[model samples]
Target: MANIDSTAAIHSHQSWIGIVQIITAATCWGTLGIFSTYLNQMGFSGWQVTILRIVTAAVIVLAMLPTLWPQLMKLSARQWFGLAMQSIVGVLGMSVCYFFAVSYVGAGPAVALLYTAPVFSLLFSKFLLSESITRKSIALAFMAVFGVGLTMLGEQAEVNWGILLGLASGMCYSLYGVLGKRAMHDAHPAPLVFFTSVVISACGLLLLPETYQTYTQLLTLPLSTWGYVLGLSLLGTVVPFGLYMKALEKLPASRASVFTIFEPLTAIALAMILLHQALSWIQYLGVTLILLAALLNAVVNGTTTRVPRWLKRRQTV
Candidate 1:
């Protein structure tokens, strides 16, 4: 009986640790908005800053390549293909859009727009992951759509290309999770991260030639600015990214998505404190609804998890 109790205790502790890792990852993600906004003010374009981040992260991973080489080599061709897809759609696509959104819209609305990822995730999963599109899932998606509409009614809301960009970023983010889950099954996170960084960096060079001017401008930044760059690369990008990938190993993406609320909340708090940004009550309500929809969907999904046991099982297969 003592052994049984001890075993259960160990499992419980492990579960909590995974939850904490996820929350910590989300918090780290929240900081990216603050950093991006700050950097933008410091004279970096959203496009430049986004590219710089992935490039910096890629350099960091390149330093570790010798150590990660073996694990990376073990990846099958299909696995590499999946990682490539994840790199294009998830890292580059999402960050570029979100940062531009932050630069265009205020951080508050940008984060609100970013949170719409869950609804996008739900839809993407049905098509990409072959997950069931039950009535409950559809209902949650509609709620999120309504929340997005309300978000557009926020104080700082502008019906501009930036708004469209934010939605695009959110949709790309959902693809990241869906693609990562599909591609990264049973794979170690470190090598995957490394590969993603490299791909994204190469893609930036190939696809975004205008970023050359941005890179040239980077050379003139003061020493203090470098500190922010390092923090953004290491803390906001790599560390949180690694933590998030690790968390996915332990928890289903559904439950993990619930904890991601900490990201926008943290982003909003930091935006207010560091950036002195705020939204009207109506916009806040919109953010609340978006978050609530995500929470409710996760809960509804959890309850119905047993019903669509095949969906969960298929993920493992």
Candidate 2:
């Protein structure tokens, strides 16, 4: 009984640590738009910013390749293919779409659109993974969709291309998550993320004709601009990713995902305070509804026989 008590205490401590890690990650992710916007002010296009971020992150990850070498070699050919697909479709595709969404609409709306990934993830899980969808899931789905509509309509008087791109970004982001889970099943998170970064950088290389000019342009930019790039690479990509993986070690994926609601909230608050962006009251309502739906989805999906009774009781409350 004493040993059991000790084990329970350890587990509880780990759970709290996981919560802190995920919240930290979400907070960092929220700052992504601000960093990307600064890069744009340095005369980099969304695509250029995306490429630079990937390349910088890849270089940093490559420095640790020797340490990850043993685990990297353990990947089967099938897993390699899965990771490659995830990198192309998930990382590259999502980054391009999301950054462009930010450039077009602004940070707050773009991040809000990206938050729709949970809705897309639910649909993908139901269809591709054959996961059972409960009535609660269905309700949440509609609520999220309605929230998206309100957010888009509240943006401007006329509809623009950014809205579609934001939705596309959400879809690609969801695809990445679903496929990444399968690809990283037996792999270490560090090496998997490293390889994905490499793939994204490789794809960036293929766009050299357009991005080459940016290299010279980069040399002309101020030191502060370079600092933003480094921040985006380290703070936006590596540090947050590491924290997220650490959180996943102790938290269920669903609960960890719930913590991501902080991303949009942080983005919205920062955009208003720092960027002087304001949203319509309807848009604010829409953000609230979407966040509520995401929270409900996370709680409902997290329910399992293995869940702690305390967590289950909280869900009931």
Candidate 3:
């Protein structure tokens, strides 16, 4: 019984650490669009900005190879393959899509779309992971979706293909989240990140158009642009990813995702500040609903009366 108590304590400590890491990750992701928009204003095409973000993140992560080299050398062939795929789809695939989504669809709507991940997470967990969901989770989902709708209020020009892009981002991110959970379950975050960085960097290279014409344009982008890109790559991509993985390793998929509310809130705040965007009373009401949704999921489910078995199962699987 003493040993059992000790193990439980250790797990609890790890879970709390994971929560801290996830919060850090969410804060970093929240800043992504704000920084990227700055770079966009400096004449970097969306693709160019995306490439810079990925390449920079890749370089930074790869720089750790000297220390990670021994571990890489000893990795099994299957692990190497997994890392390679993770790099391609997990890092680059998702980043490119999300960046483009932000650039084309605008930050608010893009984030709204990305919020669909929890919905998908709930679904996938139910079917794949055999996790249960609760009524509170359903309420939370409705709240989040309602918040997204409110965020999208008053767009003069609707996003052309914005829905598709947002959905794609959400789906890809869900895949990244689930696969990442699986990967981190048995591997260190470093190698997983390294491979993801490399994959994304390579994807950036492939998508880069020949129009860049000269290395000077590529390397000599304006200082502000560089700063924005650097911030996006380092804080937005590298840092959040690392922290997210740290969080994932310690928490269940559904539980870890509750923290994502910070992403849209960050985007909304930045949009208001940078773009001087304003929300109507109705929109504000929507925001209230969203918050209510989060509270329903995080607090109500845990402490209140027991949730329905079906809903509980829905949350887990």
Candidate 4:
């Protein structure tokens, strides 16, 4: 009917908007390395940087809490627990691993390794969400794994802990997406983001006992360093995350994961231009393969609408 057609049209439009929002978010996230590097140069440890960045973002998001309080108050204890776990494990855990990975291996490779998140996401979607995994998904997974191998091979003779940390970060990041997809069904994006930020900040505090010393050091930091932290918090963390959560409300986590390819691409480009870091040709090829696999996976998964009968029954339990 006409109403059905109108609803379809609206959904199509929203889908496009979601795509734009996620891509924009990925682009902003790509700059994380640059800001992180700057913070490192200012003598901030990875943990210190993570805490500062997250705390700043928490403050920014908390400013909106007054308006969001009504919706937040409506969440049940179970929903609150779900969001807390998502924030602690997904956001806080991922950030710690990722920032340390960046510290060890530099931004470009760290981001490249983090792109493996899509592969993890695919698997999580299969097992956790009970989404169907086609033969093509399996094929693309192999391709992406091969690409990861190529990237590691291109790293030369050095033993880098960053690779492991990056992979862990990717896995954690995928878990975040998967859990967040579930949480989104019960809450609005703004309140969800605010509470997650609060959890991250709280966890950061618990992890670092010398928080007062770090705050004291902050007083002596140059204005430029302060600006970088603010930029990292607002642009890199809050804005991108808010946009990404909004996007997730409109797109499946699997399809939304593909758009994150913009993250590494932007990071690689920025690394080369700003930091003057260059990857070997082989590594470039590897990055290309990874991206292609992500696109292919998105194409394969996006075409389906039917859930398996077993998954349907599982949902009821």
Q: Which candidate number has the best TM-score?
A: 2
lDDT of 1 by residue, 1-317 (tens): 99999999987787788899999988988888888888898899888778778877777766666776787779788776778878888888888899999998878788878878878887788777777777887887888788788878866786887789989999998888778666645454655554664555556555667667766787798877777777777788788867876876777766887788898899899988888988878778888888888788777876675423445686688
RMSD of each: 3.0, 5.6, 5.9, 3.4
TM-score of each: 0.88, 0.89, 0.72, 0.85
Model 1 regions lying over 4 Å from their true place: 74-79, 185-194, 206-212, 248-252, 306-317
Q: Write the per-residue lDDT of candidate 2 for residues 1-317, one digit (tens) a residue.
A: 99999999999999999999999999988888888888887788888888777777777777676777787778778777777777877787888898888888888888888878878987886665555667778888899899888887784613577888888899998888777655544444755655664655556565677656666688897888888888877888888888998888998887898888888888888889988878889988877887888888888878731433433465698
Q: Give candidate 3's whole-model lDDT.
A: 0.66
Model 3: per-residue lDDT, tens digit, 202-286? 6547555632432257567656666776788788877787788678789865677677677778887887789665666665565
Clashes of 3: 18
Candidate 3 displacement at residue 124 in angstroms:
3.1
Full candidate order by TM-score, most accurate first: 2, 1, 4, 3
Task: Flag regions of model 4 displaced more than 4 Å.
Answer: 1-20, 155-159, 185-194, 197-207, 245-258, 305-317
> What do the candidate models score in CA lDDT, each in turn?
0.79, 0.79, 0.66, 0.79
Q: Is candidate 3 or candidate 4 better by TM-score?
A: 4
Q: Flag clash pairs in model 1.
A: none
